[model samples]
Target: MSKISKLFKGVSGSSSSSKSKHRARGGPSPHEAIHKLRDTEDMLTKKQDYLEKRIEQEVAIAKKHGTRNKRAALQALKRKKRLEQQLTQIDGTLSTIEFQRESLENSHTNSEVVRNMGYASQAMKKVHESMDLNKIDDLMDDINEQKDVAREINDAISRPQGDDFDEDELLAELEELEQEQMDDSMKSMGGLPSVPSGRLPSASTSYRATTKRREDEDDMRMLASWAT
Candidate 1:
């Protein structure tokens, strides 16, 4: 075959070889990427083990609370199991990507091929997925601790309620809280001049308005007395 014909045939073969996964993402051969991904998975396993221990501790605390809503611990376990299953799938995909790398064309476009071979590797995807798992684990731990504190407070409240639940003081507190909230809302409204749906101004604003009204009433009385 002529050199031109041979070159044409090779180009045709290269084009035929290029597929969806081979779209270039950047550096890193498929083998190197898989190795790095394996390392990441190993690190996650250790982290998962530590989180697992903390989860057990939370479970024990929930039991002491009289009502064990182990939702956080249970969800953590579920997410850990999900990571395990994903790790297995990642392991299985490694060989397929390696094969694709070996079969890649000798042309200078191996980077593109490497990039696409990476796409099908579940290990690469799992590393990204692990980020979300870690975030969720933190959220679960926070919510669990918060709930545990709330439960402890509730248990205390149930005990022979002898502390003179000062009704007047409580009412005053509610009024103060309502007033502060009203001031905050008014300030917010003052910034944007828009009427709220069904809410009214807080107690502080009402008190101020009442004071102005009383002053007006006194001034009217003085005027009436003077005129009479």
Candidate 2:
């Protein structure tokens, strides 16, 4: 059988058996498995490098002694071919190990995800177990009742307490008192001298009338100030 094919069969047999018994036998965890696989890969990579260097050396030997020393050249070529075959096998092995490590990493991630989800579900279930719908409803009802009571209290505080008065009637009565005071002031002035009906008043009479008008204006100003 071909070397590669034989190598694949061997790897498959070992891997299958390991997987079948891994959990049952309490074997390595995913972390440990991946770590071991990585270690194997490193070792095989080193071997590959060594084999390649040896192959290079053999090729150099064959080239340097070409034709002049056929036997030595032929021996070097044979050694080179064997080293190349070993390098090829190490390459295949490294590929398999890398693939296995990646699988373990992915599986470990999936396991962690599932476990955390289960924890979340259990937490929700516990929270639900502690809660009662009836109690929640009662709490809301109490809150609403307190709100309504608060509104009623605010309304009571804001409303006028007693004896509501008509603002418009009070204003009209105040104007009437101002008019009566003005009439009393005119009486105190002995009233404007009656203008003679037929003709303009004498200069003296005009002077009294002007004085009377000035007094009336002053009284009106005083009344306005008092109102303010």
Candidate 3:
């Protein structure tokens, strides 16, 4: 028995020392540690439930031996009290375990957040490795130069190829043409009757006057023929 006890103690000590060394070496990742803590919390909670049930059972037993069996009643009460104490201990232990588990979970979450942020930072660093302000400036200058060349090409394409005419020369030629047309029209009007400078007599008077003049001219023509 002593040998067995000693062996068990040695084993326990070795296990504890190994666990301590594992902790020193950063034993479990935060996620793994949180999961284990949660498992412990669940176990403690089950124990708490069991202890509560046993306490209730002891209370019932105490009530059953109300007066007839005072010794049994006392024994039952005593057992109930011990069970209640155990339940209280379990409650405290559960609180502690729950707090520890929650703390581990929060720490794990924070660690992941920091790790992801680091990864993002590294990714950004890698992305920027091939780029610099000078290169960016040069690229922009090239783009602007291309745009200017494109604009010039578009302008050249849209412009008239070879039919350029001077606007001033064209307008002067048009004016000369108009002047020639006016001169030709004036020459054409020369053979037509001229307009009267003054107002003429009425139609009836003018007709009578023209007829009398014609008769006189005919009488003169007759006299000249007789003389001949």
Candidate 4:
């Protein structure tokens, strides 16, 4: 008996040492824990199915033995009750394991979110390290000044050259030119000869007629005096 006890103790010690060694290598991560929980749940589910089948079979037997064999029916019902109890226990265990798994998963997600937020905060801090309100304002002012200068340059470049003439002087010169043109046109019209529209004699013909008439008159007068 002592030897048997020693053997059992040796077996237990070896199992414990193996577990400690495994833990030393790397304890079960959350992911592994979740996987283990899922496997356990699946095993429990199969067990529950088996229990349900056994319960059904017991019920069928109890029905078959009805009043003819009361003892057999009683025994079958008892076995069914025990299986139901085991099924209940397994259901409770599965519920606990599932709740733990879900809680761990939620914790992991929250931790990741927190870690990422911390990283983001650091990045924002780094980005802001080189910046200040005053510097930004100065930059903006410089940009505005440059824009103003550029606009002035563009205006100067785009302006028409030789556009310094006075408006009033230009208008006066234009009026003088118009007047000279009018005067020239009038003089040209006056130099043109007028045409006779009716049967009036021309200037040369009228002059010649007048001269002959005067000569005739003088000759007639001389003859009258000689006669007197």
Candidate 5:
């Protein structure tokens, strides 16, 4: 058929053969598969670049010899067309490789997710095996009972020891003692000797008494005059 068609078929056949080989060998790991795809894509990209450069060079040659040599220009144009076709095929192949790589990546991600989920389930089963709902409830009950016992013990220790004393009786006894102390203080104060006034000379006292009697007479006379 056409060169492009032939090239496409050849690429497809080679890819199929590689896949079959991998499968026969127990299949490549996801990483290996991705690496292979990347390598193939890189090769295709380089080929595409080379084809594009060749096509550009062919187009340039065709334009330069357009009028001077018509036959040479036509041949250059034909080669450019062929290179363009090959570039198109490479683009298609690169697209396929990219799709395959993405598919492998998705599959690898799914496999990891499933494996992690399985591990989680197993861990949960193991945890459940070590624990019982009944045992948990019993443990809680024991803790509450111990807390109650501790609180009661604390209350017992905090309580006042011996018989309870009457507050009013204690206050009354304290007041009685204070009163007796105050009475003893008063008796002691009463036993203290009184201070005496100074004694005057007998002659001076007689003279002072006479002068006081004369003043009292003068005051009596003044009072009689005021009454009249």
Candidate 6:
């Protein structure tokens, strides 16, 4: 028994020494630590590359433009995200319905959950309907209204009967009459006397010189008054 006990002690001592050695080695050298850091950096680099590729794909999917297209794309992405969120909510509600269906076969509490689930489902349907509805309906209505207004305007302008209204000939005659009227206006305006070729002094310089001259006169008058 004593021999066996000594053997066990020796074995434990050996095991302890081996563990200490392993621990010393496991505490990595500075060089190994730097290498491991580099490896981690390489992994990060690969991950960044993958992410950049995904971003490039997204950019490629969109057309390039300024604010107008960018805003439109943002709106489209927002709509898609909203739809996805609704779908996820619908899925959760469906899951709840299944759970309630299985467990509470005939309870009033389960009935409420069923109704809640149904409402969520109905809400999801409504969102889909909203998405499906014509976004440009108002614009189309406005355009049609404008077209009707234009037609009304055209109808309101009562030109003489077809025989008297030769559009091409009338346009030519109207242009000639306008030219003649413009020529007469020009001749009338030309009858006025031509402006004198001289330019008056600038207002600022004129006022300054006049003020200075008046100040000099006043000074001279004061000197004269003193002399007198």
The 0-to-1 C-alpha lDDT of every candidate, in the order given, reads: 0.70, 0.92, 0.88, 0.93, 0.93, 0.69
lDDT of 3 by residue, 118-155 (tens): 99999999999978989999999999999999999999
Model 2: lowest-lDDT 10 consecutive positions: 192-201
* Residue range 18-119, candidate 1, lDDT tens digits: 533355644556566555556665665666566566656655554555335567556655665665666566555655544554454333267777777888
Give candidate 4's whole-model lDDT.
0.93
Candidate 6, residues 1-228, lDDT tens digits: the string is 699999999999997986797588885444444454455545555655554555554454444433558876675555545545655554565565455444544454566788999999999998887673476677788899999999988887865555667699999999999999987998888755677799978999999999999999999999999998
TM-score of each: 0.21, 0.53, 0.56, 0.55, 0.55, 0.20
> Which should have the higher lDDT, number 1 or number 3?
3
Per-residue CA lDDT of model 5 for 71-187, tens digit only, reads 999999999988988998888888889988999999999999999999999999999999999999999999999999999999999998887999999999999999999979978
For each candidate in turn, give its C-alpha RMSD to the true structure in angstroms. 40.5, 16.0, 12.4, 12.9, 11.4, 40.1
* Pick by TM-score: 1 or 3, better one: 3
Top of the candidates by TM-score: 3
TM-score winner, 2 or 4: 4
User: Candidate 4: TM-score?
Assistant: 0.55
Q: What's the C-alpha lDDT at position 11 in model 6?
A: 95
Clashes of 3: 0
TM-score of 1: 0.21
lDDT of 2 by residue, 55-84 (tens): 999999999999999999999999999998
